[model samples]
Target: MSEPSTYPQPPRRGFVLAVVAAVVLAADVLTKIAVVASLEGEAPVRLLGGAVYLQLVRNPGAAFSMATGMTWVLSLIALSVVVAIIWMAPKLRSIGWAIGLGLVLAGALGNLSDRIFRSPGPMRGHVVDFVSVFAPNGDFFPVFNVADSAIVCGGALIVLLALLGKDYDGRSTKEKAKAGSSEAPAS
Candidate 1:
């Protein structure tokens, strides 16, 4: 009698995720350092004919400048996110999920590091944001950093994958059903 094959093994998704996360984290930290060193309270640099600009802004809240003045609370939240990502990262079987989680992890760590070490008290430090986009009018988009960019891009990818019906274990619903049916005892 022939032995049945077990469930499909997960590809090298975790390794790829780890590499991507490391790159993102390094880029975020390095860019922040360069911005701090070069700008140092200087004015915003205009680019693309006022469509985009780089201005140093310190944010103590979450995305889009919401929840201002809640540094400690946000810090705790970000820490929790990081912990969750680290825990789930090892279990990720889908490349899509791995990439998504990696982005979230990198972003959380990037900001958390700033909150812990960049001036002010612990969990009270401000995140340095510099990239800005403007509308045709004088209105400006919220300033963000490399970490934020990674998080957004990763999130979008994950959402797209989910919409296509990919699961965390990297199996489609039909594939899972087929596997289950094959394992059932004969009538």
Candidate 2:
């Protein structure tokens, strides 16, 4: 047998990431379009005995409607996240990391598109939120969209991976590599 190859492998091309991101972006945009077209002036459509509902709302701020007067700032933050994800994609070799980054990219881009093209103004436009979870009595989770869900899931995945000691480039962690340490010299 030849000597073991010592050359480090290049990172993966992140095709899975690309595919997931594309799917999420398409879904988010299409759903938002449908909601805006059909539910702009309609009442909330309750489902599952009020456990779920569809209510179109425009959010110009972050979670809980915070910073309503700083929509431009939120837009900039979304834009920065998109750019950072793109920048980091090339270095991602693990499927888990790719998936996490892809979801984040999709979420960021989905909201960023609204910020760029929705009403109010460019970079200050409102994000279209629907798909309310739980009751609408202001005692449960805030209304969110598919993109928001993806972001949360993706972020959770990334955190889990980090806790598991996974590397973005898919290399074995140093501690793991040394786990089988042998303090003996070979003849």
Candidate 3:
């Protein structure tokens, strides 16, 4: 048999990561388009026993409308996030990490798309946010979108994994500790 390949193999979970990112990005973009087309000149649509409201709101800033005049800055930050995730994908050997990073990447790309191609020009374009929880016009909570939800969920998963000592490279903190002990210098 041929000698084992010296090249490092691609991440075992890379496929899963790609699929999750694609699905989330598609859903976010589709939902935004649908909401804009349907709700532009209409009243907010209430659903789930008035727990959710669908309305059209274009946000030019970060969460809760912070930095309302800095859409370009927000766009830059989102682009950075996208770049970082893509760079780290090859090291995502854990399924949990892959899924989490995929969600984050999808979210960043979704919002970045808005910033790059939406109204008022590139890098200064507003993000399309439509989902309002509990009340319309963001009375009860800030208006959000599918991308925002994905970001929140993915961030929570990452935090949980970190707390559990699981590394994105498919190793546990405990495993690293054991390996370090084996390589310790003798007294």
Instruction: Choose the strongest candidate by TM-score.
Output: 3
Candidate 3 deviant stretches above 4 angstroms: 1-11
Error in Å for residue 164 of model 2? 0.6
Clashes of 2: 0
Q: Per-candidate RMSD vs. true structure?
A: 3.1, 4.4, 4.1
Model 3, position 103: C-alpha lDDT score: 95
The residue-by-residue lDDT of candidate 3 on 1-187, one tens digit each, is 2344343544578788899999999999999999999999889999999899999999999889899989999998998998898888777888998999899989989999999999999999899999999999999999999999999999999999999999888878887687667667778
Residue-wise C-alpha lDDT for candidate 1, range 1-187, written one tens digit per residue? 2246566677747787788889999999999999998877787788899888777778888888888889889899989988887777767889888888888889888998988997777899999888888742124678899988988998888888878878767887677777778777888
Q: What is the lDDT of residue 52 in candidate 1?
A: 82
| Clashes by residue pair, model 3 | none
Top model number, lDDT: 3
Better of 2 and 3 by lDDT: 3
lDDT of each: 0.83, 0.83, 0.90
Tell me the deviation in Å of residue 103 in model 2: 0.4
